[model samples]
Target: MRLALAALLLIPLPALAGDPLTAAEFEAYAQGKTLTYAMGGQVFGTEQYLPNRRVRWAFTQDVCKEGWWYEEAGLICFAYDGENDPQCWKFWQDGARLKAQFEGDPEGTELTEVEQTTKPLSCPGPDVGV
Candidate 1:
């Protein structure tokens, strides 16, 4: 019984459903849209995709950051205006929605597209006070 259980544990788990989307596919589906994502059943962040690969992202109720995205090593990587290191993700289309996994860790957080709209993101600049 112990050996059987050990073998079961050693067996690799199944990968996430669906193949990762190609760069062109992602571009077509995401461009000109704003998407909100959730992780672990809680709202995580939102992002707006613009032409020329430009993007705007913000944590829930937080300030936004301007950025751009590109494909690298089969992952979609993003570079923000002031951030040095790029954040990379593997994206898969789930019916009308999208699922993303952080490429930095195979078992890292996975985000699900909770909402999408054609409207632009509401990004407020810094130091706005009465």
Candidate 2:
């Protein structure tokens, strides 16, 4: 039993997913790209990174929200139009993709990058008439 325990301890553990990305790193990786995110293996939403830290986000096939992100206390916080509270997240780069954890709860929902493209997000007007 003692030898077995020693061998187990000697085994190398797997590395962590990744470290949180800096604001500049996040911008360089996300800017000008539309990225799809998944949570719990299901599509969650999509977001488009625009110039000047502007962003457009929407649920799957839902209306878009115009927002802007800024770094606050080493976290990326987003303020959307008409929204009273800002949503913040810590972003990480996992291999070629990105991951995000809500700042309010570190063990809560985690979002993973599913797809990325240069195509602009389609935001239909709230009211369209014939």
Could you estimate the TM-score for every candidate?
Answer: 0.81, 0.82
Angstrom error at residue 63, model 2: 0.4
Candidate 2: the clashing residue pairs are none
What is the Cα root-mean-square deviation between model 2 and the actual structure? 6.9
* Tens digit per residue, CA lDDT, model 1, 21-119: 878988998999999999999999999999999999999998888899999988899999899999999899877789999976857879999999998
Name the runs in model 1 displaced over 4 angstroms.
Answer: 1-17, 127-130
- Candidate 2 local lDDT, 1-130, one digit each (tens): 9999999999999546667778998999999999999999999999999999999999997788888999999888999999999999989988889999998874687999999999998888755211
Note the Cα lDDT for every prediction shown: 0.89, 0.89
